[model samples]
Target: MGLVAINLLGGVLASLAFAFVELRPSLPFLFLTTLLVGLILGGWAATSSPLAKLYGGALTTFLILFGTGLSPLPASTPESFSTRIGFVLFALAYTLCMTALLWRAGRAAENSRMA
Candidate 1:
């Protein structure tokens, strides 16, 4: 319950900050911000979960950094094929990372409770 609320709040705040600062409305930006937020909030959730005990905080940190932080926008320019590929890869990776982290955290929390 608390994890869900924290995740939602963090995602909303990150997205709002990006939208206002960038002054542009784009799906990719929203996705990236939300994923980053999830990674952060998910890490907090992990401390109470079994996975954190097994994998430790670094795994959570890596999951956040690699999963949400490796956006390809910095690697690509606007007027090139690479830009398109970068955007696609960024979107896919962001979505996958968020999904995986959330699933892992939730499962771990449930497992810890069961144990």
Candidate 2:
């Protein structure tokens, strides 16, 4: 929990710094940064953990992106109901992909620690 909080706060700070540097970053750039940074932060948190708590890393990252306005910002809202649902599904897929990557890194870290 402490690790999650730390990463969350750090992510917020990083987002703030990014905003300061680029007052109007392109949507694609923002998304690229968000995903790349999120993965890095997630992996770092996993490595720091004494245990491979993948859920914690994923939850922390999802919250961090949400809190920092990194998610749902790169794209505008669609008018159709189905489109909205599609967007939501896309977000869910993004989270799942992130979790899968982080889980692998966390599992490796856990294995290394046991050796």
Candidate 3:
């Protein structure tokens, strides 16, 4: 539940940052909010155990990537090719991380049963 709240806060901060950029094209240092959001997410990731941290990191990356793709950024604003590539790469990485985490968790559970 705390992780979910952190993720939601990060997402909201990200959305606000993007909206600010869209509304004030002339503003400088618009990335500060985004940077803060990253820090929050980093803290969240750091709170978990090693394997769980990897899962959390991958989950966060996947959510950010997929969320950006789905966000209602102005229709007039076109997505660059590199952004698309990033989305795909993160999706694949997330899948692999999830698989590994699940395997590790299952192995631990089995070992506990055998013990």
Candidate 4:
């Protein structure tokens, strides 16, 4: 639980920084941020279940990040609705993929150590 909370905090903070601070989110920026955050959050196998911590932390962080991205864009019309939803989906997918890769690598390392 503590590990999950800590990972969640770090991931969410990284996501928020991109959301609020970055005026224009480029591909490299998104990849680097997510990769770094995921590496830091996942590479530490403090608990027995690194997979649970990684997935839980990542899913929750992005869900919250999704809300942050969706909040300001009040999608009233069809075009805006699609745009907002698409943006949210695309960003979430891209970030999650990168994060998941790093997290999985960490989990594998933890497993190897246990064996």
Using Cα atoms with residue i matched to residue i, what is each candidate's TM-score against the true structure? 0.29, 0.35, 0.34, 0.35
lDDT of each: 0.49, 0.54, 0.54, 0.55
lDDT of 1 by residue, 30-68 (tens): 567556655665665578665444333333333433334
**Between prediction 2 and prediction 3, which has the larger TM-score?**
2
Lowest summed lDDT over 10 consecutive residues: which window, candidate 3? 76-85
lDDT tens digits by residue: candidate 3, 1-115: 3443334443444445555556765435445544555565566677756544544554574457434643557643326323643555565567668878999999999999999
Reference-based TM-score, model 3: 0.34
On residues 1-115, what C-alpha lDDT tens digit does candidate 4 reach at each position?
Answer: 4544444454455456555435555667656666665565455434567465655466456545543443445553334434544555566666678788989999999999999
Tell me each candidate's RMSD, in Å, in order.
Answer: 12.2, 13.0, 8.7, 13.9
Estimate candidate 1's alpha-carbon lDDT, on a 0 to 1 scale. 0.49
Better of 1 and 4 by TM-score: 4
**After superposition, which runs of candidate 4 have C-alpha atoms over 4 Å from their true positions?**
1-11, 19-24, 45-60, 63-115
Candidate 4 global TM-score? 0.35
Colliding residue pairs in candidate 2: none
* Tens-digit lDDT string for candidate 2 (5-105): 44445544454535543666676776776676666656666775664454355446445444444334555422232243344456666776888899999
Please tell me which predicted candidate would have the highest lDDT against the true structure: 4
Candidate 2 segments whose C-alpha is farther than 4 A from its true place:
1-4, 7-11, 17-22, 51-115
Error (Å) of candidate 3 at residue 112 is 30
**Sort order, lDDT high to low:** 4, 2, 3, 1
Candidate 1 error regions (>4 Å)? 1-80
